[model samples]
Target: MTKILLETLKGNPSDRVPFWFMRQAGRYLPEYREIRQNAPSFMDFCYNPDQATEVTLQPIRRYGMDGAILFADILVVPDGLGQKVWFEAGHGPKLTPVNTEETYAELSLNGFHDKVGNVYETVSRLSKELPEEVTLIGFAGAPWTVATYVIEGAGSKDHAAVRQMGYGNPELFGKILDLLVDATSEYLCAQIDAGANVVQIFDSWSAAIPEPYFHKWIIEPTREIVARVRAKHNETPIIGFPRLSGAMLETYVLETKVDGVSLDTGVPLDWARDSVQRHVCVQGNMDPHLVVSGGDAMVNEATRILDTLKGGSHIFNLGHGFVPQTPPENVALLSETIKNFRR
Candidate 1:
């Protein structure tokens, strides 16, 4: 069977636009919440292949989405690198900060594969469980974004410390990024070897990097990961989501050589169509707030996105992950709209 999502990523037009949301499997769904409660910890939930595989299939079972991303977190890379990573109930991820060259050197890739082996098992199980028509996407955080958590030890309001280090201590910061690049590339290649039909590298904090550092931090590492993965799995499709990269989006697409580019909410439709979509398959930009405000508002905005990118290879999706408050019915309506869209 032809997987519409993979075909679209290859710049091939499907009969209808393919669609999937960022956090398709999470707290928004009551089913996911019920399952989440069973796990002792969030990291445990991700590491358990049985629970992880079920959560991954939940969204697909409910919405029949074109793609099913693996149910895992980006911090798995840090944990695999031998750093301490954990999640707080109300607060988000908390990691033991790595600042000086000493702590950085302490991170070792010796047991990286052993640490994330369960994730690969989850991917393997998902491939067998999901309908062949639905694509299985595996992903990891880009070096810069993952570096932020490593340097700051948690999510930050301004990412000041990391930025200061990138500017002030380029050698130290560059070492962290280089290590991430090697580790991320290996992790992704392993996912493909296990069964992921496609992979995405999420650079959630790309916008925080100063323009001068964009080339070294954002573009270079991504290009290296892409090159490394392609060297191993030459036929597998790779999508790059450098969220809020602005003018650098074009440069990211050209330099990284990703098969597709995901556009965030801030990207303009016309600019994305003319510059980004024209070059590779385009995958997002819907505002998550509209999903919450459902009714004609949601339908109207989704329709406008479909109309804007209808002429090219496109995958309809939210610019970011869904918030916990999103009504499930609205997701149904949004999926209905995309399924019925015509050029």
Candidate 2:
């Protein structure tokens, strides 16, 4: 087979640009909605291998993406560690904060796998069901990214709470990062064993931190995870998506040792081609909002991304996941454009 994603990650030319998006298997699709109905709750669906596998495969079946990512949230790591994590209808995820060394010490890694076992089951199912040509991707939010939710208790536009906590009490913060490095590495390795062909670490909040803190919290912890995972699962490619870390993108890719780096919407293409492609496979940089407003505008922007990055290792994808308001037809058109592109 086709295995275009894997080939492209290795810097080989593919028959077409291998494509998949961040949150590709999320709320944008109707099948995902139907599957979500069967899930007891958001966490229930994630912890249920069968439902998780169904959601994971939903977008792949509908769009024929080059990759199929597991449908589980990043906060599952915190939940597994004895922190109380929940999702309110409109408010994204929330976790009971672990602010002190004593509290962090109280959390245990024992039975962590058992708690999140369905994730491995979902990976196993996808391995057997997916066509040999399509790559199966498994992922988790990186340590620093997960920490933001754990400390702040939910999504925030500024991430001020976590940053201040990191600045005020780095010792405790460092301990949490350490625990995450160990936990996330083991979690991803388990996914590889369960048959995930690739693993991507989502450092969604990396850009929010200042330079020094960014290196200490975001870059360092991520590098440790990459090195640990690569020690055992060397062949399993890792993609690092440090969302919004514009100027620091090249440095993050070089220092973190990830096999691929995913760019957010605002990252300039020329910078990506010259700086990033030299270090690792690059995926993304298209605005998801444009997909919501599809037509010639979306088509032109998509073509421009492809034309600029055509000669290098690239994966066609939206800068982020599609929004709930996105029309199903828009997704179909975007998929068709990528699959049918001549280059």
Candidate 3:
């Protein structure tokens, strides 16, 4: 059976809007937390095919979401390129800072597949293991977002370290972005070859960029990655999630030529339906916190999202992702609400 999400991405809406949430298989799900405890580190868990595949399937098994995103980190691209990466217990991902052209030069694509081949193995397993109707989504970080972590050596509130590098020395910054573009292209293509049905590039830090250089830093690398991936897998749908890019999203959609665009919470649904959905399939914009505090209010807002985007190609999903504090029952409720939504 052709997956509902895939069909939706092709601009064909079905009886019920195909639904999935970002970070669906995450800490909010107890099953995931149980599995996570057994693994020593986040990256280690991602590199382990068996564990990764199981976690990827967990949300699908529980909520019957139409999509199953690969369970891996965006930083995997850098880690594959030989940068030192580790996850702290509470703080999140940490990488050895790559601040210099020298450090960037040291990172090579040589033996990259050999290092993170297990992620592909996980994708390979998921392709065969997922329900026939479910779409298997493979993904990576966009160059700018991944570069932020590479320069900062961890998640940042302001990305000051990255700005210092980008502004003080754009030549060096360009090199980092270029390298990321090449590496990310290769990484995502490998995932598709390994049996992924689609891919999503997560530009989580895109909003950090100023408007003047948006095209230089955001659109250019993404367009290249989209082109690179399409060159290899012409039919594979690519979804670009430049979270919180606001009005620039229309520009991103047009220039990047992605098959779909995942809207962040801040994007107005009416604007997205008019500007974005007309161009490509749109997959989100619901505030995830609503689901966490599930009730009549959550269902009402979800209904509003449904009613708003009903006219064009739409996939029901959270604006971002579910938080760890979210109740699993709430997730189930939200899933059922999406499943039940109809025109």
Sort all candidates by TM-score, best to worst.
Answer: 1, 3, 2
- Candidate 2 runs further than 4 Å off: none
Candidate 3 C-alpha lDDT tens digits along 1-343 = 8798999898777888999999999998888989999998888899999999999999898989999999999999999999999998789899999997778888999999999899999999999999999999999999999999999999998888888888889999999999899999999999999999999999998885787788998999999999999999999999999998877999999999999999899899888988888999998878989888899989999999999999888888888988889999988888899999897
Tell me which residue pairs clash in candidate 3. Answer: none
Better candidate number, 2 or 3, judged by lDDT: 3
Ranking by lDDT: 1, 3, 2
How far in Å is the alpha carbon of 42 misplaced in model 1?
A: 0.9
lDDT of 1 at 148: 96
Report how far residue 157 has shifted in candidate 3, in Å.
1.0
Candidate 3, superposed: residue stretches over 4 Å from native: none
Candidate 3 steric clashes: 0
How many pairs collide in each candidate, listed in order?
Answer: 0, 0, 0
Local error of candidate 3 at residue 229 (angstroms): 0.7
Q: Write the per-residue lDDT of candidate 2 for residues 135-173, one digit (tens) a residue.
A: 999999999889888877788888887778788887888
Q: Against the true structure, what is each candidate's TM-score?
A: 0.99, 0.97, 0.98
- lDDT string for model 1 (54-161, tens) is 999999999999999999999999999999999998899999999998899889999999999999999999999999899999999999999999999999978999
